[model samples]
Target: MAVQPSRPLRLFADYLRLERVNLTERWMKAVFNDADLSESDRLTHEQLSDHVPEILGEIFSALEDQDLDEVEPSIERNARQHGRLRWKQGYRIDELVRELDLLRQVLMGAIDSFAQGHPTFTRRHEERARHFVDEAISFVTLTSIREVVTERDRKIDEYTGQLERANHELLLKQKLVGELYESRMQITRSVVHDLRNFLNVFAMALQMIARAPARTNAALALANRQAADMKTLVDELVEYSIVLGDNNPLATEAFDLRVLFDELVASCGPAIEAKGLRLVHRFDPQLRTITTNRLKLKQVALNLLTNAAKYTKVGEVELDMRAHGDAHWRLRVSDTGVGICAEDQQRVFREFERANQDDVPGAGLGLAIVSELCRKLHGELRFASHEGEGTTFEITFPLRLDPGG
Candidate 1:
C-alpha cells in the first residue's frame, strides 16, 4: 500500500554513504581552499572539515528512509554548530551562506558524475536524485539561517552588556569629580572668611601703632607679627588654589632642604612658644640639594609643623629627615600632642573632617590639602599614634619625578 523510492534514489543514497569521505575532501578542496573566499584560507583542514561528512550521511539516510524528518534533526544540529564556529572565527554571514551553497553544489556534482558513469541510470532515478538534493539544500539553508540569527542576537546581547558596564563606570567618575569640586569651593569660602578677620585685626593693629607713641615699640612689634600671620594665611590659600588649577603646582629645582627646614621652624616659633612646647629638628647631611617642588614640599612641612604646634601641650615636637637611598628621602614630624584616636584617624585626611577635635581652630582642610599635595608629588603619607601619648607622621618622597606631569 506504500510507494517505494525509485531504483536510482536507492543507488544514489548508497553511493553517498560510501563516498562521504571523498565528497568531503572534494568540498574542502573546491570551497575552503578557494582564494576568492575571504578569511576561509585562515582556517585549518580540521575546522573546515568538521560536520560535512556527517551532514552528507544524514541526507543519504533521509533518502534511504524516503522521509525528510529522519534528517531534519541532524541538519539543525550541524547548522547550529557550523554557525557558531564561523561566528567565532570572524566569518561574515554572506561568506558562510556562500560556503553552504558551494557545499550543495559539490555534493550534487559528485552524485551526477556517478550517475553518468553507471549503465542502469534512468530518467526516474535522475529525478529522484534531483528531488533528494533539492530537499536537502532547502532544509540545510533554512537551519543555517536560523542558527546565524541566533548567534547574531547573542553577540548583540554581549556587546550591550559591555556598554552598560562602561557607562556605569563613567557615571561614578563624574560623581567623584563633582564631589571634589564642591569640597574645593567649601575650602575657599572658609579661607576667605579667615582672611577677612585677619585683615581687620591687621588694620586695627596698624591704627593703634600709629596713635600710641608711648608704647610705639610694642605696638609696632604686634603689628609686624599680625602682618606676618596674614601673609602666611594668604600664602596657604594661594598654594591650595594653585594645586586645584590646570598646571602642576610643583616647581622642581635644586634647593637646600635645611634652609627650608629652618624657615619652617622659625615660622612656627610663635605657635610653639605660645603652646609652651619645645621644637627640635635633625636633618640628614645628604638631604641638601635635590630636584622637587620646593614650595609644595615647604607647604607640606609647614602643615605638619603647625599641626604639631597646635596639638602638643607640654612635651617636645620633633622634625627629622634622612636619605632613604639615592632615589628617595624620608621625613618625620612627631609630637607629644593629644594623639588622634583610632576611630578618628581614618576620618582625619578627608575634607572638613577634624578627627573629633572641634576645639582646634581649623576648617579641617589642613591635612586634607597636605594629603592631596602628597599624591600630586608621587609621595607616601603614613602615621603612628597612641591617644594622649603622641603621634608621628612620616612622608617619603621620590627624587626624580614624573616629567610628563
Candidate 2:
C-alpha cells in the first residue's frame, strides 16, 4: 500500500497559502506602528509592501514541494533589495534586521492562531513551522549584510579618489607660489646691487669736481656720463621685470660681431691694465654680422669681461667667438683666476651668491644675470672650473642673420 502524506506537512502548506496575505498585513502593521522602526515607516505603503508577497509565495511553494530550492532565489533577491533600500533611505542595519525578526514573530503568531482554531493540531506542527521560518530568516539576514558591505566599500573608494585629486591640486599651487617668491627676491637683489655701483661712480665724480676746480668741466662731463649710465640701468631693470610676465619685446638688429668685440675689448682695456693682467681675444674668420638683440648681447659680453678682469691677477683672460655649426655660434670667456670651488659652483648662478673668495670686490649678480638673459634669448650657457686653475663660461646662440644688413 502507498503511504499517505503527513498531517502536519499538509496543514503547514494549507496555512502558508491561505494565510499569506493576512500574515503580511500583520507584519507590515507591526513594523509601521513600532516606535523603533520610524525610518521604515517613513516610506510609502507601496514601497514598504514591495517584494513581501513574492517572498511569501516562494515560502508557500517551498512548503508544498518539500524543497527549499523553490524559495532560495526569492530570499536572496529580497534581502539585497531591502539592503539597498534601507541604505538609500538612511536606515541602520540593526533596524532592518529587527524588522526581519518582527516578520518571524508575525508568522509564528499566525501559526499559533491556526492551531488554536483547529481540533487536530499537534506539537509536531509547531516545530515544522519554526524550522522553515528560522531557515528563511537566517539566509536573508546573511545576504543583506553582504550587500551592505559591498555598498560601504564602493563609497570608500569614491572618497579616496576625491582626496587624491585634492592633494594633487594643492601640491601644484604650492610649487607655483614658491617659484614666484624666488623670482621677486632675485629682482630685488639685482636692482639694489646695480644701483649701489652707479651711485658710487656718481659720488666719486662729484668729489673730483670739488677737489679740483680747475678741471670742473671734465669732472662735470664724467658725472653726466655716469647719470646716463644710471638711466640705462633703470631701463634694463624695467625690461627684466616685464620679462617675468613673458611679454617683453626683444630689440633685434643687424650688428657686426667683430666691431662689437673690438669695442668691448677697448672699453675694458684700462681695467685689465690696472690689474696687470693680459686681455686676449680670437674670432673665427667666418663669423660676421648677425641679427639679434644688440643691447642685451652687449650687456652679456660686458658683464663676462668685467668679471674676468676683477678676478684675474697675473695670467691672461681670453675671449673667443667661433662658428659652432651651420646654425649656431659659441662665445667663450676663459680666465686664469681664482677658480670656483665644487660646493660654490652649484649656487654661483643664484642671485647674491658668491664664491668663498670674499676679497674680490663684487656683488655676485653678474653670473646670475647672465644665466637669466641666456634663458630669455633662448640660448645655453655652461661652464667648467677648478680651484686655483681657471674658469671658462661658454654660451651658444642661434645664428639669425639679416639679409638687408
Candidate 3:
C-alpha cells in the first residue's frame, strides 16, 4: 500500500507561517527515515495530507458541487498542519478527533489538579507538569515515527541476522503458525465483508419501508422491526469484531443494570416462549446501577438463552443477576440442558469450536463472542456444566467502566 501525500497548509494571512509547516515536515521526514516502520506509515500519506493544492482541489470541488460560503474552512485551510494523524491505519478519523479532544482534556486536567492541590500535583506541581508534557511529546513522536517509515528491507535483514539464527536451532511448526494467523485474518475479512453487506440490506429495507404507502401500516411495521433487528445484528457483529477481530472494546455507559437485564429478557421472551421454554429472571435486591456495553451484554445473554432453548426439550432457563459491591456485578445464565463436557470446556470459548459433532447449524461463535466481551471489559466469562444435567455461564464485570470499556 502506498502512502498518500497530505494536503498542504493554507496560511490565513497574506504571509504564511512557514515555521510550523517546516517543523512538521522535518518531523515527518525523520519518521519516514526511521528503520522500524509499520503499515500505518503507508496510510498517513493519504489521510491528513500536507499538499496544499490537493486539499484545495477537493475543497474547490466541493464548492463547485454546491455549497460555497458554508464550506468548511478546516478542510480548505491549514488543518493538516496540526499534527495531521496520530496513527493513520490502526485508527479512524473520528477516533483521532476524539483522542485529540481527550489529549486536550488531560492537559486541562493537569492544570485543574495543580489548582486544586491534588496530592501528587500539589507536592510537585512544576515537576509533574514538566514530566507530563515531556512524556506526551515523546509518546507522540514515537508513535509518529512508527507510522511514517516502512524499511521492509532493513527489517528483514535485522530479523534474519539476529533472530533467525537463534530460532533456527529450535524445532517449531513454522508453517502451522504462519497459516494459523493467516486463517484468523481471513476470518476477520470475511466477517467484515458480510457485515457490510448486511448493513446495506438493512439500510435498503429502511428505505423501502419509508417509501411504502402509509396504508400498508402492518407490513411497514414488520419491515421496520426486521430492519432494526438486522441493524442490531450488524452492530453485534461489529462489536464482536472490535472485541475479537481488532482487540478493541465497545464504548460503555453507566446504565441501569436492572433495566438492561429486563430489556434483554424481554427481547428474548418471545423466542423462549415460542420454543415452549420457561424463562426466569432472578435479580439481587441490593443490586445497583452498573456501567457496561448493554448490547454485548445482551448478546451474551441471548446466546446463552438460545443455547438453553435449543438443547433442553423440557426445563427452565434461568437468568440470574446479582451485584457484589459498587464495583462488581454477576450474571449467571443457567439452563437445564445438554451440558458441556469437562474435556470440552477448555475449547468452548474458541471461535468455531463445538462440544460435539452433532448436526448443529451454529458457527460456534457465541461463546467466543462472550469470552471476548468479558476480556474487553476486563472481567471473567466462564462456563460450568454437568453433561445431560445443565450448563451455567458466569460473567463477572466491574461495575465501574473498565480500562477498555
- Estimate TM-scores for all models: 0.58, 0.54, 0.43
Report the C-alpha lDDT of model 3 over 1-405, residue by residue, as the tens digit: 112211211111111122334333444454455444333366464353344333333333332232332334443233333333343244444444443334334334434544454333343434433343344333443333443333334556898887877676443667667756875875677567545655675666667667775635665565566556456555655655666665454677877788877887888778877868788889897787677777767777777777677676667888899986667888888888878888887777765565564434344566777776667667777678999898988888788866643
In order, the Cα lDDT scores of the candidates are 0.78, 0.77, 0.57
When summed lDDT is taken over every stretch of 10 residues in candidate 2, the lowest stretch is 1-10
What does candidate 1's lDDT look like per residue over 59-79, in tens digits? Answer: 887777677776688777987
Alpha-carbon RMSD of each model:
8.2, 9.6, 28.0
Better of 1 and 3 by lDDT: 1
TM-score-based ranking, best first? Answer: 1, 2, 3
Could you give candidate 2's per-residue lDDT for residues 1-405 as a string of tens digits? 122436666677787788888888888898998889888767887777677777777766665555676569877898788777777777777887888889879878877887787767677756766677777777777787778777877888998898899899889989978976886677687667667877887888788888988888988887887677667656545554444455556667878889988888889877887888888989888999777887778778887888787677779898889999898889899999888999888888775566666456555667767887777666689999998888999999878833233
The clash tally of candidate 1 reads 0
Q: Predictions ranked by lDDT, top down?
A: 1, 2, 3
Q: Which parts of model 2 have CA positions greater than 4 angstroms off?
A: 1-22, 118-121, 175-179, 212-405
